[model samples]
Target: MADIAVSTRGLVKIYSNTVKALDGVSINVNHGEIFAVLGPNGAGKTTLMRILTTQLRPTSGEAYVLGYNVVSDGDKVRRFIGYVPQEFSVWTDLSGYENLLIYAKIYGVPRHEINERINEVLRFMDLSDASKRLVRTYSGGMIRRLEIATALLIEPEILFLDEPTIGLDPAARKMVWDKLTALNKELGLTIFFNSHYMDEVEMYADRLVILNKGKVVVEGAADELKRSVGGEVVELTVDDMSKTVHRVNEMNSLGIRDVNIDNDRGIVRVIVDNAEEALPVIITTLRDAGVRIIKASISRPTLDDVFLKYVGGKISEEGRLQEVRTLRSVIKKG
Candidate 1:
């Protein structure tokens, strides 16, 4: 536990005595790592961030950040962490320099060192040229970077970002991530963020936790999580849908246990230990059974597949809707 930057045990949060926002959630985030918290909307991702950031308290259980208890030592925790919420936290009317200056003073930076630190952060965020411009004139990505720059004024050891790139275009998102990466590498900052974007997590996160229904369904390095789902995925396109389904079911007898059929798309997804060996048998069986094989391909498991395997559903807008409905039903029954 000495190297752990954040830790929680039996964390639980309930609202209005009916809804359980966090249910026995527990996790460990190691020091100096980019750790990601991922879940569908309303999956307690933000709730966990709030608790750890000392903005909200859990109904029960304990949490610690940077060796300080979040609840009992909130002041100390605030000193060691910087938080960037999903929404912009900057003053639109203020120039970027003034914004940083205000936050630096609020953080109690030495008066003589205030301008020095502000200029350092502005250059670090690549906003030095635009620092004099009013934030209202900045682009979406520029605004995000300014927010991050403000958070850095205190030189926090651990930075918390909630959906940092939610609405930015691809280029803008990349720019934000690039600044984060630089901070992590150059300054040894620990980054803890919650993101709905799987690609970002896969690319930048050193480790991650997937929470569902207020519980940690899975936690590990992205590569390890993907491997846990099994090996390569074999997607088969067949002419006869029903026949293909029947043939795929027969594969169960051959110890191919994970097969999914999408009748609407005329495709069967098979999870196999070794695609090279399994592909031959699969094709032979389908052909012999008079099922026309139109195409077949093998691919490595993606983060989406890993999410589906554990979450038991696709990770999409519709999936979040379903989760909300399920939560409401449970609350009503309770």
Candidate 2:
């Protein structure tokens, strides 16, 4: 337990009307590693983070941070952890420096050291140049960095971020992750963040758990999880997806493990023991059936594939439409 930064067992949170935000979640986050919680919105990612950060209490089960129980040692837990909630946290009316100062005060940073801490975090987050600019005037990425800067003012051992890069552009998202990677390497800070971005999780997370309907679906290293799906994928876009699927099923020698259809894209993604052996057979079978293949490619399974295998569908953007709007508003000013 000494080396473990965060741990939870059988954690549960129930809202009014018997909505279970989290159900029997248990996980361990090692010190000095980047961990990710991934799921579609309302999957209880925020609930679990809130419980560990002491922002909300679990109805049952246990959660600990830095060897201290979150319930019994909320203050101690708060001292050792920095949290950036999913909603907008900074005051858009205020300059970035003023925003940090307010948080430094709220977090009880000593008066004498507050300025130095603010400067340090601003520099670390690469927001020193925009320190005097109003948050409303900054780009979406700048505001996000400032929020992270505020979280760091306390110099916590672990950082908890809820969808830290949710609505940023590709370059902006990469920049944010670059900063986080540096934080983990340079400060040995444990980072636990929730995201719906499969590619980001695949690239950055040392380990991750996928939650669905308030329960953990699967957890492990991304590559290991992908391999667990047990096959390469031969993805095809055909004029008649239904016909292609029907044709593929008749080829028993291909040893196809599973077939997933993206009806929206007219794609049939087949998991097979060997794409090299199965591709030719699948193509010929489809051609003989008069199913026109518009596109086809063979590639190793990805985190998305792993997600589909476990969660039974692709990740959805159902609950994040508002966040997207807010991000657009912030970016419009810049």
Candidate 3:
């Protein structure tokens, strides 16, 4: 129990008697490790985060953070945990230092230590120079770092983030992640987060759980999850997609693992036990069936592939457009 930073058992959340936001979800996050929660829109990612952060109560079951029950000991839990939500929660009208001051007051940081703590987090998050600037003038990534700085004012043991790098460009995302990685390494903070970006999750998370329709679909390290998919992906565009799919599916001894079609692009994706050994056989099979191969490529399964295998679709194809637009609107004014 001492090694576990957070644990949940049979957690459930229901809204309005009709929607079950979480259904019997259970997971364990080890101390000082980076954990990720992944899901499509309406998959209860936020609902779970709200519960763990003591913002929302679970309809059933239990969640424990750092030995404190989130529901019964909400205050104690709050003292040891910090949360950054999906939306821009900072005050854009105020300077970054002012925002931190307000959060410091809310978190009840000692009066004598408030300024020092603010300066420390500002420097730690690389925001010291921008500390006096109104948050509206900061870039999207800077605003996000400020939000993180606000959370860190409490010096909590665990940090929870929902969509930590959403809407930022690649460089901004990289910067945010670099800081987070440093936090994990330097402070040994248990970082639990929800993200729609599978690549980032694969890159940073120590372990992850994929939730869909309020249930846990799969949970493991990214590499373990990808290995579970058990094959290399052979993506090719053929002149005759329908025929290629048919030919590949009809061959039983081809050691093929799965087949899928991209109707819009006319690409047929074949999964096999080994691409190096199977690519030639696949090309030969297609050619004999009078299918013209326009292009072909082979790659190892990715986290997206692991997600689609279990969740039925790529999370990238799901919602989050409006959130990005809102953040972009904020950044445009900066």
- Please tell me which predicted candidate would have the highest TM-score against the true structure: 3
Sorted on TM-score, best first, the list reads 3, 2, 1
For candidate 1, what is the lDDT?
0.88
> How many Å off is the CA of 177 in candidate 1?
1.3
Off by over 4 Å in 1: 237-246, 252-257, 261-267, 290-295, 314-334
Tens digits of per-residue lDDT for model 3 on 161-280?
Answer: 999998999999999999999999999999999987889999999999998877899999998998888779999998888788888999788688888775545678788888888889
The lowest-lDDT stretch of 10 consecutive residues in candidate 2 is 314-323
lDDT over C-alpha atoms for residue 182 of model 3? 97
Clashes of each: 0, 0, 0
Model 2 scores a C-alpha lDDT of: 0.88
What's the C-alpha lDDT at position 33 in model 1?
93
Q: After superposition, how far is residue 320 of candidate 2 from its true place, in Å?
A: 13
- Over 4 Å off, model 2: 239-243, 250-252, 314-334
Candidate 2 lDDT by residue in tens digits, 1-334: 3889999999989865256678899998888889999998778898899999998889999999999999999988888888898889999999999999999999999999999999999999999999998899999988888999999998989999999998899999999999999999989889999998999999999999999867899989998999898679999988988787777877777788888786555689999999998888888888888988888999899998898788866443432454445445666655
Each prediction's RMSD over C-alphas, in Å, is 3.4, 5.6, 5.4
